[model samples]
Each structure stands twice: as C-alpha cells, then as structure tokens.
Target: MSVRKQQLLKQHRRNKRIALLAIIMGLLLLGFIAPLWLLPLAVLLVWVVHEAWFADHLFYSPQDDYQYRFPDGVQPLSLRLVNGRLQLQESSLAQQATVIAKVQINSSWLGRWFDPSICIGNDQQTFERGAHGVRYLNLTGQVEALTTAGLAVQGRFCSIATQIQLYVFTQPSPTAGNMMILAPHADDAELAAFGLYSGANNVSIVTLTQGEVEAEYYQRLGLSQQHAAQLKGRLRAWDSMAIPLWGGVAQTHCVQLGYYCMQLPKMAKQPDVPFASQQSAEADIRTARRHNTIQLPGDATGLPTWQNLLADLAACLMHFKPDVLVMPHPEIDPHADHIATT
Candidate 1:
C-alpha cells in the first residue's frame, strides 16, 4: 500500500475503535435514562461520537498520485499533497519577466455545501467558495519570487485537489515608432505599462489627472507640508527617469492634466458638475494658496469640463501621431478614473 493509503487505514481503524467504545458507553448511560427518551438521546450521542472519531478523515483520503507536465520549452507544473497540504511545484523558466498562475479548484460532496478557505503562494492569495463549490484564483508576480509559494486548502470537509497553469510571454523589442500611453492617474502608467513603456523608443505618457487626491494618503503617513508640496515634483521626476531606464536616447514627454482626483468619473459622467481643486485640502493652509501647475498642451486651461479634456487628449494624439496607442480597458478595469479615461 502507498504511504497515504497506509496512513488512511491506520486512521480509519483508530476511529472505528473510538466509535465502538462511545456506542458501548452510550448504551450503558441510556439504562439509567427514561425508556421513552432513550431512542432520541441514543441517536444524538452516536452522532456526536461519530463526528469526534472521524473528524480528521473528513478532509483527507487516499487517492492515486497525479502529475502534470507542460509542453516542451514551457515550465512543467505539478500539484500534490505533501504531509496533508496541497502544493504546487514548477521547473524554473529561465526568464526575468513576470509569471501569472491561474488556478482552479473543485470541492468534494460535503465541501460543496460546507465550503473552505484556499490559500496560494505563502497565503498571498485566498479564495472562498463560489457557486457549486468551485473557486478560481489568479496569482501574478516576478519569476522565482516566493520561497513557500504554493496552494493550500483549509477546511475539515474539503477534499478536492487543485489545478494550476502558468502563462509567460516574451517582451517585444524596442522599435523606432511613436507610442502613447494614456494613464488615468500619475502612478497608473508606472504600475500597468512599466514593461511596455520601458521598451518603446518614442513614448509619450499622458496622465489625465495630477493625482493630487493622494493628499489624504500623505496626511495619513504624517508627512510635512513641504514634503506634500514636493509630491507632484517627485512624480514628474520619476516620469523623466523612465527614459534612461528604457535605454531610449530621445526625450520622453509627460503631459499632466491637473484635474481633481476621485472626481474624474463623476465629472466624466456629469460634465456640468463644478470643478473642485485638490489644492484646497492641504496640510499647511498657507502652502495651499500657491498653485504650481504644469502647462497643458493645446493652450488648455485648468477646466474640469469633459469637452476640454477630450479636446486636450485629441491634441496630444494629433501632436504625437503615435503608431501604437495603449490605454486602460474601459469595462474590465475596476478603477472609475481608468474606466472614464478609457
């Protein structure tokens, strides 16, 4: 017998012995109880005894070992139970790009209704039960990132194994063409389009908003007034640094439209809403009076109107005449500003 089967057999025998003892003890106690109540009490006692004895078996059972191998040149990924925990093992893909792992898990009979918590990659990812006790989770990060990155199921009633697959795509080479990246916020381009932005030859990043709404975030961190004033400058500096990081000799253009953050979706939807300045909410009331703003293209004013915003964006497109245009997905992206910009 396999090691897992041997363990299961030993556990089953132990539970059987405990259950038998509980039944005998229950019968002995029932002799002192009223004869009419004996049947109900006996049933309750037996259920409690059985549950205690077989609780561990509810999660684990002996099953045939399974192995999964990916196509040649692709990293092979495998799922297995090691010492009662579900784990994912993979052969290293000799690349420095990010890897996204897609995992799907299905529950057994009891777990279908009871459900359980499933963890992935050092508990970085967690999934609850879904309809029909099925759950899907996606984990994305740089290659060879985590030390204990794997899948784990946590529930006494859970008994199903996990399935996982990896996706890795090669980054395109830098070419001499105009590339425009439309970012809803200052950091959006850095987060979503860093890889693409770093590879493009002539790139123009248009930030729809100044991201001034992060004032609250800075306040929460107890930053001083001087530091807060320097926030926008720091962000602009970071944008300039991207050109050197990408090995691009040509200067990268950064266009900032100083629109209020957290209000883009509302303004985009209802164009008539009055514009609110993010500078009004400042840590030091004195510094809030000074407006150090970037110049917008097309001689655009700091207007919150959707028409002006569209016109400015149009002017940027016309000026750049980009061969490749990248913007956030409208419906799929969860951020309201991203959706509005898209």
Candidate 2:
C-alpha cells in the first residue's frame, strides 16, 4: 500500500523476465570471450541462474492427502429423488417417502412452502434449509433407530441427486487440520468439493481471478459486452459468498484476490523481437471492480497490467497462515491463471 512499494511493484512488473535473461546471457558471453580466470566465474554464474530459476528444489516431503476415499465395506448410494423422497437406489416412481435433507428441495409452488420431515419410525424430525452434500444437518429425532429398511426422507418439493456417498463421522482427518483452498476461477472449489470445508475446524477459501471469466448467457440476454462481463463477475462473486454458507464457513474466511491476469510478454528472450500478431483475449477490469464480498487488493477494482499475480496471493497466505493448501496442478492444467493460482 505504500508509495515506495507501489513503485517497486511497477519496476518488478516491467522487468519480470528481462533481468534473469540478461544476467544469463552476459555470463555466457564472458565465458566465451575469456576461457581462463573469468570463464570459471561466468560458468558458475550461469549455473547459479539455472539452479535458481529453472531447476526443481532438491528437498522434498511427502505430499499431503486432500481427497477422502470411502473405507472398505461402506455402501455409497446413487439414488433418484421423485415426488418427495429419495428412492435409495429404488429407481422407481411408486414411492413418495419423506425427504429431510434440505439440499434437494426445489422450493417453489406459487410461494407454497413445505417444512419437510424425516421419519424415525416413532417420531418425526422437522428442519429447514441446510443439509447439503457433505454437511449433514444433525437431527435429534432420527439419532437412534436407523435400520436396513432405511428411515423415510421427505422434501417440500422434488430435486435431483447425481451422486451420494456416506461416511462415518469420526475424529477429523488430515483435511480437518488448518487448511486453505485455492481456486483459479469462481466455481472451481465447488466443482471439486460441495461442502467438504464445512467439516474442517479451521479453513479458508481464496479465489484468484482477474474477473476474466466469461458468461456468454448474459450476452444472449442482450446486454452490452461490458455489462455482461460485470454481471458475470458479480454472479461468481455471489457464488463465492454462498459456498461458505453451505460449508458452515464464516463469511470472513473467504477472500478474493482482485488482481488482474498479467499481460502477455510483448518481448521474448531467445527471439527478443515483436512476434506475429495474435488475437486479443484479456482480463475484464470492469468485471473485477464489480465483484463484492471479501477482496484484498485494489479494494475491488482489478487491473490488467503485465505483473505476476503472486505478490497479492502471497499476502493472502501470510494473512490466513494455513498449513494445508489445495490448488490446481500446474502442469496438468493448461490455463495461465490456473497455473498461477498455486
């Protein structure tokens, strides 16, 4: 935030690749000109450059486990929801049992609302909202009498369940430790885990974007290009807010880096000349400024300059101080922002 820091940031942006390349080239030139006393130092300098910039780190530790696999002997369900209840792999339309979990209810019938109940044979458990994919709403009525016949599940309305797997609640796993999730785009975290973070005792979600996401559906609605882009970014920002609610995460725990994607290199090293012209696909500054909720840099106004996104991201890490981080695989993923998000 300081003026001096800002000036340094600009200088860093301007020389991201040039400084390293220049040093290496100079060292190589020196070695070629004189192969005696200065030659050894130049070769060492070149190796140092390679080691710092290109080579992989020598020290290593075992990677932490992020995904949770079901233990042996646990049955996972692929059920169909019809009328009011989940058919429990029934796959038929004959039954209309009770549905209690709030996630699958469709919630619209001319403003008619149904407070669905879960049947515990002798008594009924009443609930509203909550009970998403990973986070189960704990109810008192059905705590005791669970049997193979399965308690009846009823919903106010009907919705669909694509996949459902049940895991026994025990002490928290490694994932429950202090954790942080890094998302390159808006919904990437939810695409990976619906409510997994709800189980973690201490966790935070950090979404990185230049607000460059596209919402072509908005364009179809006849909005101008900039308007559509801003709307799309705000919609994703809304998504960031809603996800934490689903996982029982406090609203403050989620943060967005309102930093734009860096501009593409106008100058190349080995080539070092203006390359052939290409299409222009850039980060939407309009969209980034519109994104609400929690953002660290630029208040909410994002930029699209030629700077690395890491400085802002590093500030986020320092603030949260989480032990475990979930991020996109740099090599496996091909998106530039996705690669930088880690």
Q: Model 1, 1-114: lDDT tens per residue? A: 457768777877887888688777877777767595676777887788556544444223523222333345756244444544444344454444445444444445554334
Model 2, global lDDT: 0.50
Per-residue error (Å), model 2, residue 186: 0.7
lDDT of 2 by residue, 1-342 (tens): 556547655655556468677877877777677766987776687678565543421221111112344456544434433443333334231122222232332323411234333443445544332222222323223323322244445433323243433333233353658888888666777776546666678888877653444556788999766666666666666677566777777667777654333222331122222222121233433344343454445343334332323444676778888888888787667666676554
TM-score of 2: 0.41
Measured by TM-score, the strongest candidate is 1
Report, for all candidates in order, the number of backbone clashes: 0, 5
Reference-based TM-score of each model? 0.44, 0.41
CA lDDT scores, all candidates in order: 0.55, 0.50
lDDT of 2 at 244: 72
Span of 10 residues, lowest total lDDT, candidate 1: 283-292
Give the C-alpha lDDT of model 1: 0.55
User: Which pairs of residues collide in model 2?
Assistant: 98-153, 98-154, 99-153, 99-154, 99-155
